[model samples]
Structures are given as structure tokens and as C-alpha cells.
Target: MRGLFLLTLALMVPGGVQATLPPPPGGPTPAPRLVSFAPPPSVVVCKGGEARVVESAPIHARIWQPWIPPVIGRAAHQIPPPPAPPTADIYTFSIDADGAVIDLSRPMAPTMWPGDEQAAALAKWRFAPGAPIKGCRLDLAPTTVALS
Candidate 1:
């Protein structure tokens, strides 16, 4: 009974078993050391004049999606004025290989929204860097964001 209890206690203690392996031929391995280096400078330039617009992908919601307020019921004899329809302003710009906006053209004439607002939003936009486009044209459209 004493030997059986001792064996069971040894089994329960994880330190009772250990893994041993031969050291590497070189000797004990050295601790890993971190190496840091700066990346090469990236310079993207748009060719003189406008680049042919290969394909104008639809504006992604992550970039700019408008919000529409819900209509609440008013009290009797208290009719609330109808809400004005949301307006959309289209913008054109060029992007580089890394999706950085190389050159941002002025907003099309007669835009209800301000150009600076559109530019500020666009500055945060990024695209996959595969094929580099010289002067790509991007269109930004406004649409209501659906609530989940």
C-alpha cells in the first residue's frame, strides 16, 4: 500500500517526468537577438497630365457612407416638416502603388459638399499595392448606412 501511494503521488507531480535531449553540435544555443532596420524610402509620382482611368471601382462604405436620421412621430396637429433628401458629391483623385493618394483633383463643379471635407476623408483611404497606377481616378458617392 505504501509503494502504490508513493507511485500515485509521483504520477500526480508533473516534475517527476522530464524531457532530456542532446545539445546541438555547436553547443548550447544562444538567446535570440532582435535586429532593426529602416525601410527604403518610397517615392510615387503621377505622370504629367491625367493617367488613363483603367477602372473606376465603386466607392467603398468604409471610406464615406452617409447617415440618415429616423423619422419620429409628432403629436396630433403638430406635423413636423419633411426632412430634406441627402445629397451626393462626386470626387476625382489619383492613387499610387501603396494606395496613397498621389494627386487629388478638385471636386467636380457644383458640389454641395466642401472640397476640404472630401479631401480630409480621402487622405485616410488606402488600396492594395499590386499594379502601380500613374494617375488613377476615383469617384466618391454618398449612400445611407444600414443599421445592423
Candidate 2:
């Protein structure tokens, strides 16, 4: 009876068996690191009567999504009229592998003002070097003119 009680006591103790096992070994985990970037300098010269050089680019346009409230206004409060849309302006410009300029009319649309102006600027202008653009152009409409 004494020997049987000792055996039962050993089994009942916490970690009595697992404590005899060997410890596990360590391992490494691989990770990624970033590198540096450097760009070159460039200059643009515009000549002639409001001339611009616009290289075409892939249009990355997104659809305009406006959210409307459930009700126009509160029932009790009187609301003033919403402000009118700003006057639309025309713009034009051109781009190359390096850079671009805006407000060169040459019959094209505008760059700074609105979509319709930009479309008109694109339709009328021409480009040089024939390279692509991931760039932008900005200029006041009609009054402002550029040469590139």
C-alpha cells in the first residue's frame, strides 16, 4: 500500500513528467528592407505664339461620387440658398519625359480650371520628344497663356 501511494503522488504533481524533456532549439526569421532612389534634373523652354508640347499619357480618371443627405434640410429651420458654381476657365499645356507647363492655348483646353477645359486643352495642343507623362499641369483659364 505504501509503494502504490508514492506512485500515485508522483503522477499527481504538476510538470513531473514534462520537466524531464529537452528544451527546443532557436531559429531565424527573414525580413525585407528598403532601398534609396534619385531623380535627374531637367529644364523646359517654351517659344512661339502660346505654343505647348503635350505628350499623351494613360488617363487615370476616377468617377465622381457625391453623397446626398436623406433630407435637403431640417423641417423647422430655414436654410439659405447654396452658393452658385464658380466660373469655368480654360487652360492648356504639354508634357514630356521630364516635365510639363500649363496655359498654352494653341486651341487646346485648360488644365487648372475644369474637366471641359482640360479636354479642350488636350485636343488643341501638341507635344515634343513624344514621351509619356505621369505628371500634371495647372494654369488660369483664357487670360493666362503658356509656351513650351
TM-score of each: 0.34, 0.23
Instruction: Kindly list the per-residue Cα lDDT of model 2 for residues 1-148, writing each as its tens digit.
Output: 9999989999899767554544332222112222111111122233322223444322222222222223333442343333222233323345544434444443443232245534543554445543544333333222211121
- TM-score of model 1 relative to the true fold? 0.34
User: For each candidate, what is the lDDT?
Assistant: 0.45, 0.36
Model 1 lDDT per residue over 70-141, tens place: 333533235334333234444455667665665676546432334565566556656545455555444343
Of the candidates shown, which would achieve the greatest lDDT relative to the real structure?
1
Give candidates' CA RMSD values in order.
23.5, 20.9
The CA lDDT at 13 in model 1 is 95
